[model samples]
Each structure stands twice: as C-alpha cells, then as structure tokens.
Target: MNLEARKIEFVQEFLKLQSEEAISRLEKILRNEKKMSENRLVEPMTQDELNNRIDQLESDFQNNRFKSSAELLAKYE
Candidate 1:
C-alpha cells in the first residue's frame, strides 16, 4: 500500500491496542521518532549566515549580554 494507506492501517491497528504496557512502549517510540525527524529538518547555515551570527554574538558579548562560566556555575552550587 501507499504511505497514506499504510498510515491509516497503522491508525486502525493502533486503535485496537489494549495493553497499557504496549501503549506506553509505543508512546516512547513515537516521541523519539518525532525528535529525530525534527533534527533532520534543520538546515545548516551558509558561510555568510554563520559570519553574521558570529558578529551578532560578538556585539552582544561586548554589550554585557553574557555571563561568565564561573558565575553561572556558582548559582547552582
């Protein structure tokens, strides 16, 4: 069958699932699959885009928009 048909078939079969353990396992698998798909959808920036991002970060740093690593760690301790 085609993708949509298979998806509908999966939905029909999934609706027939009754065991709590089976459903919980399926839920975990679906969450991991979604995270993986989202990561795959992210496109890498070009060289000019990367340079602009670095320039913005440098400006933010110079304007005191960042914190030191030691200061950040001290808050948790």
Candidate 2:
C-alpha cells in the first residue's frame, strides 16, 4: 500500500487501542521519531554563513523591507 493508505490503516488501528501502556509507547515512539527526523534535517550553520545572514538582515532592515509588529498583527487579526 501507499503511504497515505498505510497511515489511514495505522490510524484506524490506533483508534481501537484499549491499553494505556500501548498508547503511551506509541506516543513516545512518535515523539522520538519526530525528534530524530528533525535532527537529521537540521545542521549547524558555519560562522561565515551566519555573518552573511546577519548582514543581509541588516540590509533588509535598513531598506525597510520588513513589516512592523503592528502591521503583522493587524494582518492576522
């Protein structure tokens, strides 16, 4: 089966879980897997890369390329 189908099947089985221990174990596994996946995807930035990003941000701020906090809040609201 495809990923979506497998996920649906897993959810259906999960919904039928009657044991607290089983549910807790699944939750722990899910949390650990999520953390592992995130760790795998993220890497530490080099000092030069970090400095370049800071410089770019400063340039953007000086050029007024960003919105104010009030403007962002108003847009969401």
Candidate 3:
C-alpha cells in the first residue's frame, strides 16, 4: 500500500482497538514519532552570529549607511 493508504489503515485499526491501554500506546508512539521528527531539526544561528550581525547594524547606523524608515517608505511612493 502507498503511504497515505497505510496511514488510513493505521488510523482505522487504531480506532478499532478502542481500549485505554491501546490508546496510551498510540499516544506514546505519536510522542516518540514527534521527538524523532524534531531530532532532525536544525538549531537557529548562535549567539555569536547574532551579536556580530547587531554590531554590523550598529556600525552602519553610526556611519549613516542605513536609511531611516521614512526615507525607505518615500522610495516606494
């Protein structure tokens, strides 16, 4: 069977079980699946990267290399 068909069959079988123990097992399986999915996730940029970006922004601002919000909007109109 295809993935979607297998999923539907699994859900149908899960519904048919209808016992507290079965439900608990399904919940544990879902939780583990979620954790496994999350395990493959990547972390955001490090604090050092963020600090460097902020420092670059501050340097640009000090040198008037950045435009004010009003000046940016004026370009659009």
lDDT for every model? Answer: 0.97, 0.99, 0.92
Residue 43 miss distance in model 3 (angstroms) = 3.9
Worst 10 residues of 1 by lDDT: 18-27
For lDDT, candidate 2 versus 3, the one ahead is 2
Q: Pick the candidate with the highest TM-score.
A: 1
- Judge candidate 3 against the unseen true structure and give its global Cα lDDT, from 0 to 1: 0.92
Backbone clashes in model 3, listed as residue pairs: none
RMSD in Å for all candidates: 3.8, 7.8, 11.6
Question: Which residue pairs collide in model 1, if any?
Answer: none
Candidate 3 structure quality by residue, lDDT tens digits, 1-77: 89999999998998899699989988999999999989879578899999999999999999989888999999999
Show how many residue pairs clash in every candidate, following the order shown. Answer: 0, 0, 0
After superposition, the stretches of candidate 2 with alpha carbons farther than 4 Å from their true spots are: 47-77
In candidate 1 the C-alpha lDDT for residue 75 amounts to 95
Error of 2 at 15 (Å): 0.3
